[model samples]
Each structure stands twice: as structure tokens, then as C-alpha cells.
Target chain A: MAGVAAEYFLEAIVIKPIRLRGKIKNGIAEVKALLPHPMETGARVDSEGALVPAHYIEEVVCQRNGEMVLRAEWGASVSKDPYFSFKLHNSTVGDKITISWTDNLGDTATGDITLA
Target chain B: MHRRALVKGLATLLSLGLLPLNLYARAVAAFTAEQAADVYRELFGSAAILPSDRIHIKAPEIAENGAVVPITVSTDLANTQSISVVIDENPNPLSGTFYLTEDSAPEFSLRVKMGRSSTIRALVRTADGVYMSGRQVKVTIGGCGG
Candidate 1:
């Protein structure tokens, strides 16, 4: 098992902590995403009793088959390690789904998937 | 062993395929109309939220884990321009906002942290300069990171 400090470090510097899953069902595309983030509200204290600055994903964008499908804005209130799912109409199997997010601290991550 | 058990439990729950439809009942108790309106004023610089049923929100009635409450908002209304989600009882009431394009759908889903049982509100803006609002989702857990 990893210590809490290691876990925090992993969350801070880790790359591509996002997992995107896309599936076509009955002519509609279902997309599910799992994003691991501290989403630190900056209101919490660290083990050293120091305030952790606000670090959160501020924006998320999704593209389907090279076309923009969705966009989202987030804040510190979002949970650590968030999950989201939505449906896209007029999509089919073998199409591509791409997701990207940018945090407040200027960290960004991207993940892509092929619908099956 | 404990981590293994937890993983197994989550896998079982996921396999059951019930993660998508977690919303059970509607619980509206955290914020009053007045408070929610005040939050609206603070965010948009006005208190002109027109109540409309076109906007829809799907969320769990009782979030066992307040730290991560899943919420989905969608609407079929035409000319929708923007959407904003708010947690009325949080220290900062405004949660997030989405700017929409003509080609974009008027829907999205995300997770939010709730400091306590509070009302989740979605405010939508249309192209005609009219603001349409949806119903409030009541969260029963205090998921404050503080």
C-alpha cells in the first residue's frame, strides 16, 4: 500500500489519469469517463497542517468523430476523482471519442477511445 | 484484503449495471427560493431566473458519499446558450458553468462536492436573452473537503 504522501504526489504529477469508455448502443453512443484528481478545494489542510492550494479541473471538452460533442466547466466543489457519463445521438460503432480536461493550476490531460 | 474487498464490491455494483440510473427520488430541502435567488444574483449579477420545466437534472436523492455526487442536466429547449450548476449551501455557491454553441447539445453530466445537504440548481440561458431554470436537487450528505 502506498502512503498518503505518495498518493498525493501521484495525483499532483500523474499524467493521463483519465479513462474514457465509449459504446454504441442502438444507434446512440454512450460515453463514460473516470477522472482521478485531488480536486483540492484549497480549503483542506495537509498533514503538515499547511493549506493545500486550490487545484481543480476547470474545463472539460469531448469530441466525437472529430466533431465537438460536449463542453463543461468545473470548480473546486467537484469531487476528487470524478465520473461522468452521457449519450450522443446519431453515433455508430468504430467512431472515435476524445476527452480532454484542463485544471485551474494549468495541468491538462487527454484520453481517446474508439466506440465498440 | 480490505482493498481487494472494496474493489470486488465496486465491480459487483458496476456489473449489476446500476451506476447509470442512480437517481431515485427528488429531495428538495437545502436552499429556499430566496437563498437560491440570492446566489443567482451573485453569480449573474441579476435575480431574473425564470422558472421553467424544460431543463432536467438527474441526481441521487440521498448521496451516500457526498464527496462525489453525480449530476446530469439536459434540455430540449431551442436556442439554449449556457448552463450553470450551483450548490446553494456551499461556502461558494457557484459550482460551474458551460458555454454552448449552436452545434452543441444542451446537456452534460459531472460530479460535485457538497459541503452539506444542499440544493443543486441549474441555470440555463437561451439565445433570446431569457434565462430558464430547472428544478433543484437536494443532497443529503455533507461532502465538504474542509
Candidate 2:
């Protein structure tokens, strides 16, 4: 084949961990999370005055029991140690909740919660 | 040939139809969009966003530090498909966008950075149309720019 001998490229993946916290109160399931990330803006200088590369979470996805609830597209403008809070209506206790995110550099993590 | 087998194996998946949904969530261009107007353009495509009382944006009137500013956005509009936030002074003003489903309310709380004093615009996309609201935030110190 013409392209049979073409070089193959391998992709590497990195998995991070996410911490989740939330509680259901008054029939509303309020969920929030703190994502520990550097959230570099790519425009900042290091202590040595060298430009720091941009590294930040680009997307956040939340779901309830395998169904999508909230999906977010984020940029580098998010502050360091990004955190978010969202509410779920029509959801009851013991429903499984999942939160996940992928960064600009492709680092990803998933966090899980069960309503209490 | 090895290449032929590789190509054939890749196409053998029967679940190809669900691929679009996976790709839709990874739109990097919209996240990197520099201007708020460009972001809205990509969503509405020349359609005007109406000023609405249904959308609400809550943010501190003055931020002591630009690194982290707390903001909350909620909307009363029904059937909201998405909610987005834009900071007028940031280099990439389109801070983020949220796509919601029936299980969740059209409200979220997040922290973002501000380069300077700016207007925080929150928009909601519903079946009826696009509606938005804006709140001013004064920054005593500018956030580090990228």
C-alpha cells in the first residue's frame, strides 16, 4: 500500500482524580466540586520572568445516573483551583452523580457522588 | 497488508453513529474564542440576543483580588439549552459556557479571573430565543494575564 509504511503515532493519556462534595436539601440536590489544577493562563511569567505555558481545564461535564445534567466549556480565564456549584431538580437522594473534566493538554479526571 | 487491516478494523465498529455526540463536547475553538461577540455569533449566527428580565447574574460589586471572583448565574427561562459567561475585560472574554439537560436547573456558580474592571454578561439559550443580562464588577487588582 502507498501509505502502508507510514509511521504510526502513539497517543498518551494521563488520568487525574477529582474531589466531589454535595448534599441534597429541601428536595434540591446541590452539588459542588473543587478541582485542583494549576490553571495557568499561558501569558504569565515565572519567578525567573520566563513565560509560563498555558495549562487549564477546558471542559467540565456533570451527569446524574448516566444522564447528562450540566456540561461546561471553559477557558484559561478560570482561576487557579477551579471550583463550581450546580443544582439538580427532580433528582432524589441516592442518585449517582458524576463530574468529569478535561484540560487543554488532555489531562482528565472523574469524580463521583451519591446523594445523601 | 498491515495498513489495510488497520483501516478495516477501524471501520468495523457498529456504534459509529454515536460519534458526533462525543465530538460535540470537545469544541476547543469556542472555548478559545477571544471575543464575546464571536462566541455569540457562533451560537446565534447573526441573530440578536434580547435583553431579558429572566436572566440573573450575581457578582460582587468590587473584588479585592482579581485572581478569583465569585459569580453565580441563574435564569427563569424555560427549556434552557445553555448558559454562558463573558468577562469584558479579559483577554479571552468568553470565560465559559454551560449546556444543561432536563435534570438540572439553569443555574451555576463558578470562580473566574478578571484582568480589570469589566462587565460580566450572562446569557441563556432557550427554545424561545437567546436572552442575557449583565453586571458590573470592579477589580482593585488586575488578574495575571496570559
Q: Across all candidates, what is each one's fraction of true contacts kept? A: 0.54, 0.85
Off by over 4 Å in 2: A1-16, B1-21, B25-27
Candidate 1 C-alpha lDDT tens digits along B1-146: 45346556765786798565222211112212236556566555654677778888888887877788888988877888778888777777667777666645577788888777777788887765445554445566577754
Looking at model 1, residue B97 earns an lDDT score of 73
Best by TM-score: 2
Off by over 4 Å in 1: A1-16, B1-47, B102-104, B132-141
Candidate number achieving the greatest DockQ relative to the actual structure:
2
Docking class of 2: acceptable
**Clashing residue pairs for model 1:** none
What DockQ results do all the predictions give, each relative to the true complex? 0.24, 0.48
> What's each prediction's TM-score?
0.72, 0.84
* Reference-based lDDT, each prediction: 0.71, 0.81
